[model samples]
Target: MKVQNIRMTATKKLIEEAFTDLLRKKGIEKITIKNITERAKINRATFYAHYEDKYQLFDEMIKGAATELINVHTKEENIWNQKQVTCLTQAVFEYLNQVKMSCPYSYQNLFPLLRMKMLNALKTHLESLFNSNNISEIKEFNILMYSRIIYDAAEVLVVEKTNLTYTEVIEEISEIILDNNQSF
Candidate 1:
């Protein structure tokens, strides 16, 4: 039973990776079931066995990446240290970087669906961590504000509009978060 689950998971990952590779090289509009099946070395029939269409595959890929990116930043219960936010920034950047690195033309393809959720989720993470701060408690407004800064910084990074390194961006935001300092 466990083996079957593992096998399924592996197959799913394979499909996502294959699709991502194709997307990286070309625009999403250019990808087809034949393309993915060819890349994954699976049968065309097997492709439909897993997903309804390319968009479905893309959503699964984004969601899986989203969960992973969210987990990297907000997964642990730390004191909102520089390291944790760094992880968050790195996770997000890494996701975008992968797309950009492999599929520069296609990276933006996921942004429309991915952007808002990423922003909101980052805000939630910031607020959650802020609420748990030992010295300063976070309010809703505070979280929203800090989250905007983080989102903007992250967006800049995603869009290649900023020169800040991922760690530097997180560090700068930490300062902003500290400035908004409140106690619980």
Candidate 2:
């Protein structure tokens, strides 16, 4: 059973890697199941066993990436502070930059999906932070608004491939969050 689990994990990783590679080369719209399966060195049966279709696989991949990205900046007992906020913004910027660099062509194709996933993850983390701080005045809607602002800023930076340094972006976002939260 353990070996089977390990094999399943390995197969999934291979499929993911192959899909990423194909996405980079052919872009998502052009990538077919045959393309992914051929690149993964797996059959259609294996692909179907792992994912219903390319869209499902892509959705899962984006969600997984967003979760990992959020985890990188959050701790078990994350404190809601400017520094942590800065770090979170920095993480988002760096993650998006990495994605842009790694998959230039496909990045544009996948930006909307990636942005939404990242935004949702960011909003969840921000809500947790706000709740932990006992900031009862700040509603869920406010938190969502803040998350959207940060996400949009980060998206613009990534899409533009701006000349601004990570620190500059981080500081700006941190200031925005700190300033807005002070009202609560």
Candidate 3:
């Protein structure tokens, strides 16, 4: 039997929204379960049943949002292309534009956990490119480094969107990947 089961969608959504609303107003350190429960209008028992504490609740919310964003970016059915990558990058930019503070806060809070998930997804995409180009597999260490760099770069880029156009950002990344492949 699983110990953690988020069975009730409505209650879960309420708890999550309460945290988001609270987060927008103040930082996580200031948030407590009492505040969340009161804001959510749900009892503490329901909150505890789904989550262990405030940190988990914060993690759950941030993680859920990260997964949703990643899914939105990677869910395209068509063959991968530069156009699609550009569109995905622009979408990232647009998402940041819409929720500049919230998105970065989520990224900062959840990136370490979410980074691996995103990196794995990126590695699959990069693997496809390697296959298409007849390139060899990247080493595990290199993939790990690349993944972390990408996460850091994207997070920084999201916060610094006003300084760079989406196309400019995408082109710079493409150039770096191309240069890296040529060097290897």
Best by TM-score: 2
Q: Report lDDT (Cα) of residue 27, candidate 3.
A: 60
What is candidate 3's CA lDDT for residue 47? 93
Q: Can you list the residue pairs that collide in candidate 3?
A: none
**Candidate 2: where are CA atoms >4 Å away?**
161-165, 180-184
**Candidates ranked, most accurate by TM-score first:** 2, 1, 3
Q: Which stretches of candidate 3 lie over 4 Å from their true place?
A: 1-7, 64-68, 75-81, 84-99, 103-117, 124-136, 160-163, 180-184
Q: lDDT tens string, model 3, 1-184? A: 2333444776899998998888777666667899999999989998998899987876566454443564576566234445545544544444444454764344345444455555565555545545666656556665555444455556567654457665676776555543555453
Clash pairs detected, candidate 1: 24-103, 136-182, 136-183, 137-182, 137-183, 137-184
Could you tell me every candidate's TM-score relative to the true structure?
0.70, 0.85, 0.68
**Relative to the unseen true structure, what is the C-alpha lDDT of residue 175 in candidate 1, on a scale of 0 to 100?**
74
- What is candidate 2's lDDT per residue for 101-122, written digit by digit as tens? 7777777877777777888888
* CA displacement after TM-score superposition, residue 170 of candidate 2 (Å): 3.2
lDDT of all predictions? 0.71, 0.78, 0.61
Please give the lDDT score at residue 98 for candidate 2: 77
Clash count for each candidate, listed in order shown: 6, 0, 0
